[model samples]
Target chain A: MVQFLQQIVNGLSLGSIYALIALGYTMVYGIIKLINFAHGDIYMLGAYVGFICTVQLGLGFFPALIIAMVTCAIIGVVIEKIAYKPLRNATRIAALITAIGVSYFLEASTQKIMGTSAHSFPDVLGTQTFNVLGVVISMKQIIIFVVTILLMLLLQYVVQKTKIGRAMRAVSVDADAAQLMGVNVNATISYTFAIGSALAGAAGVLVGIYYNTVSPLMGLVPGIKAFIAAVFGGIGIIPGAMFGGFFIGIVETLVTGYGSSLYKDAVVYIILIIILIVKPAGLLGKNVKEKV
Target chain B: MKKLVIALFVFAMLAGCSSNGGGNPAGDGYKIGLHYELTGEVADYGNAELEGSKLAIKLMNQKLGEDKYESVEYDNTSSTTEAVTISTKLVQDGVIGVVGPATSGASAATYQVLDGAGIPVISPSATANNVTQKNPDDENSEVYNSVFRICFEDSYQGAAMAQFAYDTLNAKRVVIYGDSTTDYAKGLTQAFTDQFHKLGGTVVATEYYVAKDTDFNGTLTKIKDMTYDALYIPGYYNEAGLIAKQARAMGIDCPIIGGDGFDSTTLVDLAGATALNDVYFTTAYTTVGASDALQAFIDAYKAEYNKEPGMFAALAFDATNLLMEACEKAGSNNPADIQKVLVDIEFDGITGSFSFDATHTPIKSVLVVELVDGVQASAVSVSPKM
Candidate 1:
């Protein structure tokens, strides 16, 4: 029981980071119907930015995090403008392939700039673990969880109440119709990219603090898993993405704990298969007609 | 497009001209081909080896000033393709033998070409047993007879450490966590597990993660409640350092043991000073109490590079000088004669006394080092039991 609870805490902490990344995938897919595969590299960029700030510039942790978020948000807009906007009318496959190309380019460029070695992140928060009822809790874990929740709440507020959020939903539903309704679909799309990329950047900084190392290609696996989470929760559904990310994290941790660690990744893909077979629309997704 | 064609044609002609010197010498000095990763993922290892080889060549030239050799060096960038390409170029360049390609994977990738071309290749620190031993993945599964390494095979490391754990530390229960992708890590893990069980030790659990996965929280959390006398991690410094930090944070109090992969100074740098307590690894050399010659080499290295030499550098120095000695003894820089001479040569190296076994693998003792306050303090020298 205590062991189970400990695993849950571990799961939640891991899941929250995944959720933050999943939100990016979900948001971009919602607006443009493109699975911005380069989103994860944005996360890596965020970590490096925060790394430069905290390690090189001697900035505080929160300030570094904010700077990373802002920089990545701008980068996101620029990437969409240069890479995606031109290919908007092209085939979806072409855009997806370009997303992958962009991802590889970002990875190679980062590796060239900062050697492929993993840099040890300095302890921004003092290293201290408190044992509560035989379960260990660290400051990084608490901060990661709390920040993720608060960010999600802020996201919910923006989506539910803000005019930009309304435009975002309008564009996601039908871009032509949203343009007809004077939503300025291009601006909405750029705003969506900014928010999504900013979230991924925040997740990147949190991971650097939690894991104590950052590398050029660190975003590849986490990015893939977050994409899987988006798909598992129904792509383009925001709340469902959070649910899926958390679920994947908990299940992955539990599988590793009770069963073989070797099977952990295999089990996640297996669950994805089962989910697709059972509910193609996902838990929180709805079936909608599409125009060919 | 025409310019590109012209450039490629010029490159091919230059390559063809170099092939004219294959397996033969013309000048007063012999040419030796060198491949080291100056830039890449493991560039640190490559760069250190590069410095050591350079220093060794310079020392040899000073001693035999008139007969000093010229080395043709190339950067493989730690890529297997580049390693093979450079090895091919080296053979074509008519080098007597090649000194290094740095890591085991890179060395293995170049072996097939070097072996078929009958070129003798000695890697300074490639420790995977299959480098000279039979690689099951090979098309013929035959030993690459031309391949040799200066460092002790990884299997010996695992077995020696397990024996020490069982006999010295009285660790009857242990858990193994290792990298699954690389042959070096897998070979060590298997050897350790076999030797541990043979010594009446029970391995409570064995876990694995690929190279990229940084977070070991899930695996550590599972082991949190389990009873184990020690934790054995056989992987590179980057992952090992992080694992040590995360394990310590999770309140694991057991002694963590590792292989030569933990030899890098970055291990201490990454794992943090406070978390280094009880961390131990089996490595090549410790300069704490060394012979005057070894101390001299260390001093020279520091003076030249303004930094301490890592194990890779030390191994490379031995590799280059040892090959130089073989060339002198054979009275020729011919690859075949050098290969024959290398089998019988017995010499003292910076790392240890080196004598080739039947397979050209060095017979040497492994030094165990412990981390205290992020410093590698020498522990014990574990020799192979007779």
Candidate 2:
């Protein structure tokens, strides 16, 4: 029972990270209805920015994290403005291809600048284990969990109460109606990207702290997983993204703990495929009536 | 006027003949090709091997003093297909010998190219046992003659590490993890498990991860439930670093052991100082406890590159020096002559004294290193019992 509780705590901490990253994926999908593949590369960029700010420029973790978030937010806005916004009327495939092109370009450029070797992120928190009811948890895991929850709650408040949040919902439901209601549709899209990119930045920092390493290609797996989480919880649904992230994390952890570790990834994908087949709209997604 | 024209013509003819002599000579200006993975996942390994070849060529030219020989370099992109393409290009360029494909997988792909050309190929780091292990009765056995390795085979390293874990650390039950994508990981894991079980140790659990995976929570949880004395992760530093960190996070506190792939400083940095404490691995050489010659090489390397030489660099340096020694002993620019000399030659290297065994693998001592606060310290030498 003690071991079971310990694994749960571990799973929760990991799930929180996935939640932060998945929020970025789901948020963008809600507003734009396009899977921004470059979103993951933005996370990688955040890690590199944090690395440079902290290790090279000698800033503290909080300050470096803020700078990383702001920098990534700006890049996100620019990318949406230049790449996606221009192709809004084009086929969805065009936008998808552009996203992929942008992702590859970012990865290659970063690799060229940073070299192909993995860089060591500085340890912001000291390595000291704290015990909680016969389960020892590291200080880093606690911080990651706390930060993730705080960010999620803050996002929830923004989307539920704020006027801009209403505008975002309006845009998601019907872009023409939102513009008719005096909402600056383009501005709302940019704001959505800014918020999503900032969240991804935070996720990148948490991952670096948890794993103790950063690489140019490090964002690929988590990025894909977060997208899966978005789809699993119901794409375009806020609470759904959170639920999916935690669910995937727990299921993957349980599978690895109980079954063969080699089958962990296989299990995650199989669950996604099965869920999709049974309920195409995802766990919390609504079924839409086709105009045709 | 006729006599003056004859003299001028003779002078022009002599100059043309001398320029042609400088360009090419019959069986004199031998070309040695190098195929390495200079880019991709294992680029670091390829870069080190290439640097070693460069250093060897510099030393050899200095020793030769204007000898008519040239080295041609090619990038193999760490892919089998690329290695094959590069080997064919090298053969087309009329290289008498080739230095490396840097990995067993790549070497296996390009084996036919060099074998068909009858050009001897030597690898600086390819450690797979089957690389040179040929079927004696088969007509294609001659394909094995053209290939050799400067590093110890996986069998030697596996058994050596297992014995160290069993006898030195008294580890009775060990868990094994490997990367499924790499032959290096698979070969080392198989060898270690075989030797450990043979020595009456139980493999409590065995797991695997892909080459680029960053998470190990699932695998770590399973291993944590069991009672294992040690964890053997025979894979490269990229994934190994994350595994070490995640294993610690999951509360699997057993000491993790690995092979030469863990020699990168990046591993220490990736795993963090606290998590890497007590982690052990086997490597070719360490900057600490180096021989006098090895120390000089390190000093020169530091002076040249403005950084300490890692184990890959040291292995490469040794390989180059060994190749030069073979060239000198052969006293000819002929591939067959160099091949013959290489088989019988024994010389002290930066890592240790290296000589070829019957399988064309190097016979040398392997060093066991312990990680102290994310830095490699306390290196001890081990030799295979056989």
Candidate 3:
């Protein structure tokens, strides 16, 4: 039971990172209906930025996190405007392909610049562990939990209690109707990317600190896993992505802890299949009736 | 417009002809392919091996009093498919033999492609057991007769470590956390487990992770509750370093032992100095107790590159020298001739003096290097009791 609890602790730390990245995937899908495959690479860029902030610039963790988030937010807005905007009217598949292209471009360009090697993220939070009821938790894990919850709450306030948030919901529901009702759809979409990418960037910094290693290709697997989490919880649903991230993280950790690590990915996908079979929409997603 | 198109086409042909004219001078030397990971995740290993191979070639040329060898080099970027592509290009360029693609995965890819073309290929650090022969566990497995290596195979190194852990360190139980995605790690794991069990030491738990995986805390937490005397990680420095850091951070301060994959400066950078205490790994060569010949090679390498040469450089130097010696013995730069000579040749190298056994693996000694406070303290030579 202690072993199980310890695994859960590990899972939560990993899941919070997935949750942070999943938010970006869900928000962009909610607003523009594009999958934003490059969302993961943006998270990777955020980690590198954080790496520079802490290692080269000699900033503390909070400052590095904030700067990384801000830098990624601008990059997110620029990517949407330049890459997705041109193909807005073309085809959804076209935009999706462009997102993939953007992902590759970011990875290749970063590799070309930084070289393909892993960099050790500086240990800003010194190692400290706490034992509660035979379970071990580290200071880094606690920071991850605190940061993720705060960001999620801040995201909740932005989505529910702000004018821009209402505009975002309006665009998601009916872009043409929202435009007719003076919603400024393009600006709302850009804001959506900004907020989502900022969350991803924060996740990146957290992961760098937690893992103590960063590389150019670090975001690829997490990006796919987070996308799966978003879909498992109900893609395009704000609360669903958060729930899905934690759910997948715990399940993955438990599977890896008890069962074989080889089957962890397979088990995650199988659960998704079962969930989708029961409710075509995700666990937190509502089934929308199709209109012809 | 048609006339203009024809004129442009003619101009392009002329440009291509001029570029082709600036190629290698005819019959100046024999072209030996140097395919390696020049710029990728394992670029450190590749570039070091390249330097060693270049140094060997320089000395070989000076001895022969002429440029009897020329390197046709290509960077595989630490990719298996890229290694295959480079092998095809090397074959097309009429190279006699190829020397690299340092890691086992890429070396395996090149061997599969080059074996069919009857090219004699040598890998400096592709230590996986099955690189020369397929299905090392099976007796009837096919062998890549033309493929060979300079360093001892992974099984030898793995067994050596297991023996050291049991006999020298006096550990009765060990837990293995290995990389499952690479043949190198799998080979080491298999040999270590078999040898440890044979030595009457119990293996507590065996956990696996793929390359690029950073989160071992979940798995580590599970293993923490288990009873184990030592932990053996059969993987590259990237994941091993991270595991060392995490393991130490968790206060699981038992000794950690590994194979040659842990021989990299990046290991120190990744794990940090404080976390690397009581770590041990098997390597091909060490400066701890160097022979005069080995020290000479080290000094020459230092004088040439102004940096300490790692194990990869030493192995590649030996591999290049071995190949060039075969070429000289065969009295020709023919792949078939070089392959025939290699099968029956005995070579002396900085790493050791050895001849290839039936499986094309070198019968040589391995150094088990230990770290004290994250710095190399001592290396003791050990032979696996196979």
Candidate 4:
């Protein structure tokens, strides 16, 4: 049905955002074995940074977005150095708690600075609709989908072919071994944060343009949902996060479209619960055998 | 030496006792506490409510003389727990009456504290019907009896919005998007559907989003395929603004109607001028005109704070005045007497006036305002048919 197809397109577009944010969560989890709770808040900061560049500084969309990505990358490195780096050998729980604290501190700071009001983002892509198979899709949605896919491919290529990418995988596998093999373990981890935060920043800009609104706490829900997507897809698995994000987005859309809208979020969480119950490791996560 | 010593001790004791009683006097004067949210996502709403209360207080003080009553204020900062804490502090401070805990959730939290202390608390904007609909025989019913409100319940506002869509806008079918987190949103959606269907309009589809959701494309896409005359979104400004922007971007292109939750400058700022064009919403009052009373309040507010008072300020002003009027009519600061007088008293307000019903819900006119280029242009007053 046209309606069904349209919903899928809509789902994919939203899912792409979730996918981008999920990658950040998955990568951090993959390397650090810690859920960076503040990752979402970093995405929020990215959006605000992009907002300031575009709205206040009068930069074009692309320039502002690039600046936002670079800014977030720097913030990511700083956060890692200041917050996570010091606790590199700390318990996972301690790192997680620190992440949460950082998240709260960032959200509170944004609220204080931004004054708890929603700011309208400048319309970058003109609001024009293109019809495909009796389904009307906006230019913004199309751009978001295309850009997300391109970014995902770029990430895949980077991880598979690049030197730093190998270093990241090596570090993830065995940080001590990688360090012994002359790999800069800390630099690799910082690089992972940089890439993850940049992706989150891009997601922020995309969402801001798509939603046409930005707020201090805008990143919180999407951040949580993206993390769910990462776990659902098998946390630490890059492609898995992509699949999971799209899956969650489509499922949410379908549930709200056909089922009771009130229970849509409930349905999404239920899916996550069911998926987790079925496969403790995740949909695509491998069962690791711990060496004695 | 004994007389001198006794005189000094008595004077010191008398001074201490007077200081304690002087905090709040009896029939000669009264203390009314205002608990409102001054910060957070709904800060604008709280700010408006506070402003209205302030204006009302100024008028009451001017009419009754400042010596007749005293007013104190507390900011709940848009937290339910804070509302409870503030209400406890206010009651401890011996406020004879209290006004506002703005939102329904905050009101629910403060109700227990204020009701336990036998203080009459009235909210100008807390419209959840259940807030005042307590079981008469239940022990908790005491809270409901002491609480009152100036705004009509969502039941009326929802029905009014539905009627406007069906009769005025002549929409044949409507799609409803509701925010499920707040009782205000759910209540309005229910009312809109019940009244719209009752009036022979078909609700093609209904969607929902949470308070924190920024994406509505999935839901909007579903509705885009369906033929609908108008979209009814019953949600607060935060989500509503995003919904409006995304809805427009999706090419749904139907008029959107909402409730007082949409009466925020933030909504326009969030939605943008192009997106918010032709949007209609309902509110308790409007700041468009300079009516004699409104102008005077505005002048006083500007003189005091050097800024134009928003709608919440006007409502708070009226609420304060209403309490003072009740006190004067009762000729006492006793909570029970003032409560009875509040229920029966009807005075002209900036927005207009009606006495409270048994539920403490005011029977007043609702204003339907149209957003013209990001500003409220026209306001029409609608009263319940009953």
lDDT of each: 0.84, 0.80, 0.87, 0.82
Model 1 deviation from the true structure expressed as Cα RMSD, one decimal place: 5.3
Off by over 4 Å in 1: A180-185, B1-86, B89-96, B133-142, B290-308, B320-334, B384-386
Which of the two candidates, 1 or 4, achieves a greater TM-score against the reference? 1
Better of 3 and 4 by lDDT: 3
lDDT of 3 by residue, B236-343 (tens): 888999999988887789999998888777788889999988999998877777899788888989999886777788899999999999999999877888999999
Q: Can you give the lDDT of residue B16 in candidate 4?
A: 57
What DockQ does predicted model 4 obtain?
0.29
Q: Which has the higher TM-score value, candidate number 3 or candidate number 4? A: 3
lDDT of 2 by residue, A213-291 (tens): 7787778878888888899999899999899999888877777777777787789899899889988788998888889
Q: Please estimate how well model 3 matches the true structure, expressed as its whole-model Cα lDDT.
A: 0.87
Please list the residue runs of candidate 2 whose C-alpha ends up more than 4 Å from where it truly belongs after superposition.
A81-90, A174-186, B1-34, B55-77, B88-99, B117-120, B132-142, B242-255, B272-278, B321-347, B370-386
Return the TM-score for candidate 4, rounded to 2 decimals: 0.85
For model 2, how does the per-residue alpha-carbon lDDT over B177-234 read when each residue is reduced to its tens digit? 8887788888898889888888899988888887767667656766777888999999
Per residue, candidate 4 scores C-alpha lDDT tens digits across A1-292 of 9888888887898899899999999999999898999999888888898889988999888898899899898888888887899899989999999999888667755664565667778887887888887888888888899899999999999999999999999999999999999999999999999999999999999888888777777887898889999999999999999999999899888887888778988888897898889996789998898989
Candidate 1 local lDDT, B119-147, one digit each (tens): 78889988877577566444245666677
**1 or 3, which is superior by TM-score?**
3
Off by over 4 Å in 3: B1-28, B37-71, B77-80, B134-142, B290-310, B325-332
Q: Give model 1's TM-score for chain A to 2 decimal places.
A: 0.98
RMSD of each: 5.3, 9.4, 5.6, 8.8
